[model samples]
Target: MGFNPKDAIESVKDIATNAVERSADIVESAGYIIKGDVSDGVVGIVSSSMDIATHSVEKIKEIATGRDEDVDEIGG
Candidate 1:
């Protein structure tokens, strides 16, 4: 078979374009595609912070309503 130079160049261009399209599809499907495992870290930190804040609020309430002593001063 005889090879045509123009056809070869067009084939190469098609391949490059196809590769680029496939790559774009993969990237778009994967979402933002940032540099780190940001999900695990952000979720863990937010959840742990919420837990700590809840516990602290409970502690403050308990202190504001002391069992042994009258909390007259602490009451609003």
Candidate 2:
């Protein structure tokens, strides 16, 4: 099939998610925080991917759950 942006996004999202989860596991095993502030630490682990899929998911949940009024940025 031709290139698919959705598939690309999903793959990056999975990668970021794995990084976050793996980092969390490491933190839990060591009984200490990963690095920096908790929120930044998690994002830092995923930042290398240069994809916003995870953040978009978070923003959507924030809006849907009423945790925030809207996404930090509109749709890509």
Candidate 3:
């Protein structure tokens, strides 16, 4: 058996996706508690979470493929 980069990348992607979803759920709950509505929270959470997840996957792919030049560019 040998280490697989593809599997590692996929695992990271899954982690990131799950984190985004969990964060969204937390935001929705908090919004309902504070504003008595989940619409605003849902809208914002969906938009921002998708962007975050997409960017995370893109960065992970770039890093994995050796396409990422400036590591500092991450999270900036």
TM-scores for every predicted model: 0.41, 0.36, 0.44
Instruction: Predict model 2's lDDT versus the native.
Output: 0.51
**Superposed Cα deviation of residue 60, candidate 1 (Å):** 0.2
Better of 1 and 2 by TM-score: 1
Cα lDDT tens digits, model 1, 8-76, are: 555556555555655554454345335465675455555545555554454444444433233454464
- Candidates sorted on lDDT, descending: 3, 2, 1
Worst 10 residues of 2 by lDDT: 27-36
| lDDT (tens digit, per residue) of candidate 3 on 1-76 | 2345776676677667777766767676567647866676666667667766766766666555455445556557
Q: Compared with the true structure, what per-residue lDDT tens digits does model 2 show for residues 1-76?
A: 2345565566557656766766655555344234336665455545533334555565445534444334444443
Off by over 4 Å in 3: 1-29, 68-76
Q: Which stretches of candidate 2 lie over 4 Å from their true place?
A: 32-76
lDDT value for model 1 = 0.49
Report lDDT (CA) for all predictions. Answer: 0.49, 0.51, 0.65
